[model samples]
Target chain A: MSKNLVEFNNISKFFGSVIALKDVTMHIKKGQIMCLLGDNGAGKSTLIKTLSGVHKPTRGEIIVEGKKTIFDSPRDALDLGIATVYQDLALVSLMSVTRNFFMGREPMKGFGPFKTFDVEKANNIASERMGQIGIDVRDPSQAVGTMSGGERQCLAISRAIYFGAKVLILDEPTSALGVHQASVVLKYIVKAATSGLGVILITHNVHHAYPVGNSFTILNRGKSMGTFEKKDLSREKLLGMMAGGEELDKLEVELKEIDRTLKN
Target chain B: MSVKSKSIQNKSKDERLRKVSRLKVLLNRPELGALGGSILVFIFFGIVAGDTGMFSAYGTINFLEVSANLGIIAVAAALLMIGGEFDLSVGSMIGFAGICIAIPAIYWGWPLWCSILFAFSMAVLVGYTNGILVVRTGLPSFIVTLAMLFILRGATLALTRLITGRTQVPGLRVLIENDPIAWIFSADAFKGLFSWLGSLGIIALRQDGTPLATGVPASVLWWIGMTIFATWLLMKTRYGNWIFASGGDKLGARNVGVPVGRVKISLFIGTAVAATIYACVQVLDAGSADTMRGFLKELEAIVAAVVGGCLLTGGYGSAIGAAFGALIFGTVSMGIYYTDVDTDWFKVFLGGMMLIAVIFNNYIRRRVTENK
Candidate 1:
């Protein structure tokens, strides 16, 4: 079996008197895309924050490469080869593509106090990597705000891949995109998985996840509903589970009664 | 084989489609609007006051001197604004620092150098306090520094009066008249150049038939050096990227490990130190410190920065742009005197210029960001 890049061992997070996440155990393996499915307020954000080292879990441990580890900051998690691309993409729109590509980890040249950003090196790498991801950025100096929504997503994804991310966590990357842009992002997710990196795709849409997800874990109101393999769960069953089977059935009956009353 | 050739052709076509014109890129620079405005202002003044020696070497020097004084503070203010904060206390800090130097050197009998060092330390402390309060309490820097402005101003008046029973402190230049350090800060380095021009009759002469006071002021050199340093720091250094990111989107920058809070704090310190430097130069040249020495300087610096194309909202600006903004201000303020216009109209001109520059900057930003 492929090695587990990162595994959460029953992690629970609490804020004051509220439980943000409770006993959530999910793991992403190498070369596999794990779809973390949840509706709004399903504790997806809290779980991801724990995973990305934004917040520490109140209980339980995070196991990485078969050993437990504690991350003090997002920098620590990044050093461990874990990269999270939030829905906002953490990009400065006013800045250039090259600038955004190497915002924190800029290449340097010269010595001591004379050291400066290696602009040529940064520009070349940014343009080359973006091209590899099918984004034909004309000038690396162009402000990122000028790019299309899908193209910006591509830039963020390509940036992660270039930085040698072993595990990539995408937090609702497609939630704000259109149907076509979302599909383009899904294609990149498949590409990232094929490149031998572990990917956690957090999303509310099952159709977007079904085509790319190797495994699925559903969360409902701070609790894990179930974890299922692609072979074990059919598309209809996964959708039914996500919508809460009993509630969805009642909802459908009520909708039908309303329709019959309107016809009368 | 046919499909492969077609795909290659399509890829090259896409590349061609994405190629932007060089002019478009140049126009997209943050400083472009400021540069154009400076040129236009220069031309307008040149035409209106050209016959009155506005284009003469003397008049050029006059405006340049005025610009240098404001440019020094404006550049630092521009950087702080770019880093996503404001320092309204810079004007009052100048007065305070001046007193810090003058009181120790003249009254306490401290050496000039020691007094200067003491003033610098005070400046840094005040700057650090401003930064910490803003960062720790999550307060808007505008309000924090606004409070600091009043505090520093009131303290300058109260302390100066307490020490000397007066608002003005004199004898700074006399005390350090022959000191080597004074020469470095306040002396003209290019005396030979102006004297040579005077001899050649290229520049005006004094009534005594000697060359009028004409040499490159040390402050001017400092202004140029600081502008260059700031430009290089913003354009060529890793910290420059952090400044842009911090101002552009603080939370976004923090998520990517940009140390946004530290960057902002350092910027505050930087602005304070720049104000201190300005105060030292001004005091050494004038030979005194007054409680009202640098009134409204903070507003002028901010206006210069805004005219230079720095976004009042932060995250977008350039040091070179601010420098040009100062140049425009100096030319207009002094050029009005040469053109027979009432000096009172200068304030009106300043206001109109700022509004026009802001509107132009907004238009350029929209064009750059919305361009396909």
Candidate 2:
């Protein structure tokens, strides 16, 4: 009975004869973690582009909160409370942490036609937001580029949460992270979900998602493999499906045969 | 239960604050140290000029006035640079705007305000053209604005000759002497206002009933006020953030739903408007507009921004720094005048200083960011 915050109803996308996404129907519930798994060229990027309003689907509609809406630009999607965090978060490396967090919506003080930057409030708010996300980053005045990759990702996520994003779309957030670092990012994803925001996690790593995801959608060559509830699928099945089980098995057998002949 | 929860929450908040302070320490790690060349120049100027009356209030005011003119242009130029573009035509635009005012005020007999308005509109139009061509056609701003620079310079020369029959456009005496507009363009407003306020000082209020007045030059006051405003815009406003983002990562800014095109256009307009404002002041002070005035001054403005700590690639600069950079240039120029040093040798010093500062800035960035 939970209403969908956003839904792609049979959307298709194509570049020349190559289909990027084919009749993909998927929905993100208001308060749940939805993971999209795929290898390279599995149309995951295409799907994200469509959802984040980077591109309009070649066919079908995007339904949001029981009403279908057409998003012409990313701002339109953002207005609907959908924030997309890319692999490389858009942050000025040299700018202070508070500046990066409040990039588009900075607070100003003072009266009349001449207003001043509310430095105290901005610094305080940035610090508070970072604390909420369990990032004990020292002064909000610190430069963003000084933070590690994982920490920057956390900052980006926290920024979205602070900006009142109803739905959070993460693009390969953990791809560049080490095991421990990825675990840190995964914790934040869970935290975001628990805070009552719909999280759409885009990643190729099934292991990273297995523990956190409530539902899964696998894509292959621009088409949806299926959408599965976490209880309905096993870890092995998901991996096998992603690696193309039969083909990987045949390749493994052939490699073994060659090794045995060489030994003989 | 409520009391316990509240105490626990307070404890957690305190813990969080401690952790955040630690992170702040990590982030404040210096990317670059203080600029060496700027310091050296200041020392050289001080040592050479300080021996005489060069360090006097009159000399200081003269230097500050020069800086004010340059700083005003440099601030907007820095904004454009931070937005990832450059305008080489700003200097020529200054000449053109002055000519616009001169022609209307003298020949057409228009009111001073009307002429000033016309000049400003012309500058805005030129800025719009630069923005449109650069953004719409996807041309490199360097090339487009460079072309604009030459075009405007040539046009200014030809027009001045055609209208005035000389290289200089004449007839701004009326505004300078009588018009109220002169107060804004030439008079030492900053000094006057501050003297008035300083005279009313409660701290200086003595039983003797004599209030001391502090004379702050109009140019210095203007520069300081503008610096404050520019700092606020860059640090606090949404538009200011857009400028930084667009300059830092134009594609990234666009990806994040920033109106990159609009931001660039506005900055272009701002730069031109600043030029026009400076032009009006310069013409009022001189009572004539020279076609060759401000030749290569655009480069100086850019140099000021770069020396002030703006990354040449875009993003990362402070308006205060740019103003400081202008101060360095202004002082060097006037300092040379006060000293026995020939003005011709000044260019060599300026060039060497610029080169050294760039190297130092780069080294600092590398040192701070490498480990991080």
Candidate 3:
């Protein structure tokens, strides 16, 4: 098994008096695809926000590579090689693909006063990285806006990889994609993990996570229902826990009874 | 085969647009609509002023000179606009900077270079103040720069009265007549470096040690160089990307580690520098800083930028477009003068041109996005 890369220990988050996450603990191993599953308002966003440096946990420590690191800003997380591919991807649609790839950190050619963007290098790297991710974008000079939604997500993923992100946090990357497009993005996610990135896939779809995820953490009402490795949890058991199987079935039966009485 | 080979082909004028990237699409997008309007204007002017010297070298020179001056300011304003801000103070900045040059050169009897440098530095200083106030205070740039406009104009009036004992400072009449340096800056230097550069490798020699072609005006050369530099900076640099990103979405840019504050401040400085350049040349040529000069120069500059294809909403524009827009203005001004048109009616023409350009810009924007 791969060594653990990041671990959240008893982390909790609150908004005023309401609890968002409670006593949640999980560990992501290096080169592993870990899917974090939850329903609406089940703390998926809250957890990812804490992980991506968007919010500070009300309780507990986040240990990365065995070091308990405190991140004050998203930039701090990024500098430590933790790249979060936000849902919207934070891309300037009118900028070129190459320009977006090296938005804030463009390579420079000349030294000192004559320093300028290394345009040739940027164009080459952008093309090569896109190709590496199996995204056959014909030209790096194309504007990012011209690309389709799936292509844009792929570009952002490829960009993070190019920037040497050690751990990639994707925030619902496939939420807006079609079935085939989602598969394509999933393929890239798997490729990223295989290529040595510890990827955290944040999604609500159990089916999307089933094939690629090596470990899963299910959250319900701000509390962890279970954190299980692939071998530890059966597909049926996972589904049952996800829907609170017996209780939800009973509730449905009760609703049916109520409808029958009203009709009578 | 990758499942998505379906390309959206735009059946517009040129078919190759389908293969163009978003940035190029946005950059070249404005050019087409703007060029169309320019052609219409050209045809109209050509018919009305055909027999007159509308195409004469002297007339062309005058138009070009005006274009160069206005183009510098427009280019600077375009940069600021693309970064999602406006500076109403640019007009007053012109007056202020011009006065700075005149005061040192005329009153203190400083050398032309020294006085110009002093004035340029003061312009940059004012720019720094404007930028800091807007960015740090989170105030609307419109209000901040508008306030600056009034303050600078008032200061200029007060300073002129205190120094010259008159509202209007006389043109640098003394320097134009006596100073050869001033002549080099304003009047064309004969048989020298500029003609060579403009000739593009063809040398002109005469019997009297004079060149067959005279050097182009220094201001013209300066304008060309600045345009080239600005273009290179905008399209071919990392900072350029940051500018677009910051202007498009400031929060997103900041989240991604871009220094939004610094870029904005730099933009203000660029605008001020451009204004100072224009003021220096204008004062040198007229020999006195006009108190009421550059009164609406800022608006004209902004209008030129907008007509050239800059989006007032920010995050989209081109340096070349601004230059072209300035050219259109210069041509119209000269064309109006040459034709028997009332010169006072020029404002109406400018307003109409701006309205037309804006509408055309909107049309192109819609057409470009209709597919998505």
Query: Against the true two-chain complex, what DockQ does each candidate achieve?
Result: 0.72, 0.33, 0.27
Model 2, span A39-65: residue lDDT tens: 888889989989999999999899888
lDDT of 3 by residue, B78-183 (tens): 8888898998999999999888888877778887677778988998899899899989999989999999999999999899889988766674776666664556
As for TM-score, the candidate ahead, 1 or 2, is: 1
Q: Give a tens-digit lDDT track for model 1, residues B243-293.
A: 999998898888888999889999999889989988988999899999997
Instruction: Give the runs in model 1 whose Cα sits over 4 Å from its true position.
Output: A256-264, B1-19, B207-209
What is the per-residue lDDT of model 2 for residues B174-244, given as tens digits with 9 covering 90 to 100?
Answer: 66676766567767644555445546663232355432323444556667777777777887677888888
Highest-scoring model, TM-score: 1
**Clash pairs, model 1 backbone:** none
**How far off is residue B344 in model 1, in Å?**
0.5
Give the TM-score (vs. native) of candidate 3. Answer: 0.84
Worst 10 residues of 2 chain B by lDDT: B26-35
- lDDT for B55 in candidate 2 is 62
List the candidate numbers ranked by DockQ, top first: 1, 2, 3
TM-score of each: 0.95, 0.87, 0.84
Candidate 1 lDDT over A1-264, as tens digits, reads 567889998999999999998999998899999999998899999998899999999998998888899989998888888999998999988889999999888999999999999987897788778878777876677788889998998888888888889999999888889999888888988988898999999999998888899999999989998789999999999898884665789999999999999999
